[model samples]
Target: MVVYLPSLTLFCDSLWTKKMCGAVVLFVFMCLTATTHADHHQPCHSPNMTGLMNVMSLKGDKIAQGTFAYDSMGKKLRFRSNESYPTNTSLGLDLLMLFEEGIFYEIDSKNQSCEKKKLQMLLHPLDIPDDSRFYTTMTAGSASIEGEGLKINIWTGSIPHMKGHYSMSVTMGCLPVSTFYFTETTTLLFSNMEVELEIKDPHLLVVPPFCHGEPVEDTPEGTVNSFLNEFM
Candidate 1:
């Protein structure tokens, strides 16, 4: 069985915006981001460079746009994502990546609701006789790329399908600019990575007002959480 967990491949959301072209199906394309941090629940210093970045997808459909900031201690991110539905109606599901006690909150600003889930180091299962082909190293010019730096050399590939890595840059540190959901036959891309080296405001990482009074189902300790909805 193939298990899906919040690794790197999902990117659907944002801070300072509520723009989700809700059509139910767009929710199928919804992606949540949870990357490596120094520690969760515990407070830490912000990364050297912190700034807002744009999230993009190939084939016309676009994910939510958001910002990210990190430090030597931990990281914080927020975004909303959706596809072009004919409704002309926009409903963005806001998310706040504030991890506490192995948990973080995914919010729906439109509904003024929030759901929390645990942070797990998720792995994927891939079937390939030559596993080496799934990995590669490259360096190029990323002047227009977000988080672009002196050189653009990084490793990228996918574990079957989930946890698809699309972008990686190392100027100040090893930073993952974006993720993807693709098979050997299809592909998706993320650009304008916008990596900054600074510390972000700690208060901004807090959950928004919408999630203030919402109840949540917590992920039990040591459970393999395939998705946040698993707890929902």
Candidate 2:
């Protein structure tokens, strides 16, 4: 079964104005309060072998979009676009090859397949930070992932434009069994604005579908608008 999570978009002519900054500050306070309250309850359970599988798709203010598929067994496949803005012609054309674990596949954008030599590199795992407590922060953006199950969060601002934060949790059941809890916050200033995305699914050591042709460029504007509306 497919579950569609709500998507959000924020449009501001200028995030640097004093009024916008105040609104952002209030939003952050609310998020912190909500998170604090939720933490007091039972911790969220990670996905397991018997849990449901899910696919999560995310689009960020026309800057980036991607999709991830996850099974109960900590395995996942992710595809991310390279374009700064989503394009009707280039939608789903760019891909970032990622494995269930932290391993990255050598992507062949032309053929849309993994290169043999690149797959060989999978003999070893990629070097990723294992610290689960480290939380990256952001504002006015959104992210999603599925490992053992699906986890996603959306924030309200932009990098170098606005300030906000995002949170996520996912479980993977590969070999050792792992779960991830992640959080990130960001503050944008005139000089620089940096947003960090964190994924913290934990399991010991795990070892880890395709629609044909390009996405239709002339997809009706009404359909596209409808899809965007569902998120709003």
Query: Each model's number of backbone clashes?
Result: 23, 26
* Residue 148 lDDT (model 1): 41
lDDT of 1 by residue, 25-58 (tens): 2443232122333332211122344443333334
The lowest-lDDT stretch of 10 consecutive residues in candidate 1 is 123-132
Residue 13 C-alpha lDDT in model 2: 23
Q: How far off is residue 80 in model 2, in Å?
A: 4.5
- Model 2: runs farther than 4 Å from truth? 10-61, 80-102, 112-166, 169-232
**In model 2, what lDDT does residue 36 have?**
16
Name the best candidate (by TM-score): 1
**lDDT tens per residue, model 2, 39-129:** 3222222232211111122212223233322233344333334434344532342222223433333344466454211121111011112
